[model samples]
Target: MAYTLYYWPLPFRGIFIELLLAEAGQPFEKKSPSSIYPDHRFDRPLPGMAPPYLVEKGGLQIAQMPAIATHLAERHGLMPSGAEARAAATKAILDANDVLEEISQNGGVQMWEEESWGEFRAERLATWMRIFEETYQHHGGPFMLGEEITLADIAALGLWAPMIHALPPLEEDLKRHAPQVSALLGRLAQRPGLEAFLTAQRARDGQGYCGGEIEASLREVLGLKAEG
Candidate 1:
């Protein structure tokens, strides 16, 4: 039985899970978050505040992107062997999650102001990029864990690819601050399965990254024309 995923119609956290399933050539069913909100409250497979939920064929339901990612990586042979290596992988996923939160300005709890946005781009965002770059360099290669393309690599791609794709200006920041991470993204994007999945995603979303007012605020701060 294929897995089932619950997420909004955006390529944010959900993309990480999709990339993993695509790389492993595993099939999954995608459902909108609204499908479980008929009563104005989440009718989730498991109790969770928000989505990016994964329901396994064996009746195990999991929430939280990091937990779901680790579960899928372990089950699909995408995680590295041994406790230490697995811990590293988990760290990478959590790091990716943190970066997402930071970029979204804590889920857009406060809209980005020009001054704050500038500061974040120059400092915090640059630091996050360097962190990913240093991780790739420490591993010594194309993949995050060195030679093998594990979920760490996938997580990195999920974190940056959509961001760069949607906000083309940030591509320069990534290329400059995290050249190694940028290259890894290029390599990962070339994978046949991942490539096809991204192609379809782009066709459907058209550079729509993390949809909503937060995204609009982001685009504005970047001086890009407001998206519809």
Candidate 2:
């Protein structure tokens, strides 16, 4: 049951794989950017393009966050069992990705402006969160897909961690506009496996996800000072 995960040292996209493994209660070895050897390069072109890959028994390799996450979830039965639930889970993941894209702003340049953040807080943020909330309520709460944990829950949880980490200001807004999602922050943290990983994650790296390169740029664009 040994497995290996590869990703950049930062928690950004890599953390999603970790969340899934943790939720499954599966043990795995993780390799970060600093850990990979230079000669690890292939003599020929390889199948993969970037980090956030996973390796399993029989030398099976999986790349891309979505495929890796879906494979792991389906294999571990963390994916929804019912068709309707599965569809909802898929949609939930898409919604999460869209939010990630908007917030991340691609290539680590968050072009956040006062007006942009204001409009997002007023318009986009609540709408996206409400989408997740409705699905959670429809599935009957506690988990995104009812009693069973699904990839969507892991996806949503992973997405929230980075956003909260990068911007503390959003915390107050989240509680006010998306209370259900805010409540989930506590619920997901209490999961035994996820709890251990979070404790470890907090301990291991002082560096924030996406780091100051993006954070500084975002702060500048947002018209914040050296410290925010």
Candidate 3:
């Protein structure tokens, strides 16, 4: 199947969907930034406000990171069978979206100041991370949903890694406060295809977070040369 992904050159939000594709061992073509539809075109509302849309070979178009990842998971076996498990996994994807918004308050237009960073670290950040961690634990897994990798694991790990990169101070505490989450990252990093995707993306200089050129968190994890 030919999968075409349209996003800014950066990995930010689009990475999660890409992670699902890579983990499924699927090959896809990433559209270049210059070729992506003008952002202003999507600036109206709803589906019009984002990049990272996907076009499948069958002519189905999907937009939004969570939507795209979940859809792909269904077809590629990244999401497991059974209604409860599927619903739970999709809920986890939404949780990751909430986590993304919490960290990226302005949608990556700016970086965090000291006071704002403190507020995030103190309350919302830990709360969001725990939501994911508890879900992982409840599912009883080496992967989310237990025994098999699913959209939840891919989405959560995708959120965790780059966000951790953009905020270096959290690294030490993240491991301290949520060891399983850290352990999960370690495990996911070992997956050959994902590791390669991350490595290749990070190697690109100036690959911004949402194209803002400010996300500094991925270097340690992705070996990113992009400016912080």
* TM-scores, all models, native as reference: 0.94, 0.83, 0.83
Candidate 3 segments whose C-alpha is farther than 4 A from its true place: 33-47, 108-111, 205-208, 213-228
* Residue 125, model 3, lDDT: 79
Q: Candidate 3, which ten residues in sequence have the lowest lDDT sum?
A: 213-222
Q: Give the TM-score of candidate 3.
A: 0.83
Task: Give the per-residue lDDT of model 1 (tens digit) for 90-191.
Answer: 988999899889888888898888999999999999998998888888874858987788989888999999999889999999999999889889989999
lDDT for 60 in candidate 2 is: 60
- Model 2 segments more than 4 A misplaced: 33-46, 219-228
lDDT for each candidate structure: 0.86, 0.71, 0.73
lDDT of 3 by residue, 1-228 (tens): 589887767667778888888888899988864444564444323343566778788666766778888888999988888998999889988887877675666575656666666776778878777777787778846987888878888877788787665545567766766678778888987899888877777686233454443344323233446564
Ranking by TM-score: 1, 3, 2
Q: Indicate which candidate wins on lDDT.
A: 1
RMSD of each: 1.7, 3.3, 4.1
Kindly report which residue stretches of model 1 are placed more than 4 angstroms away from their true locations once superposed.
37-45
Best by TM-score: 1
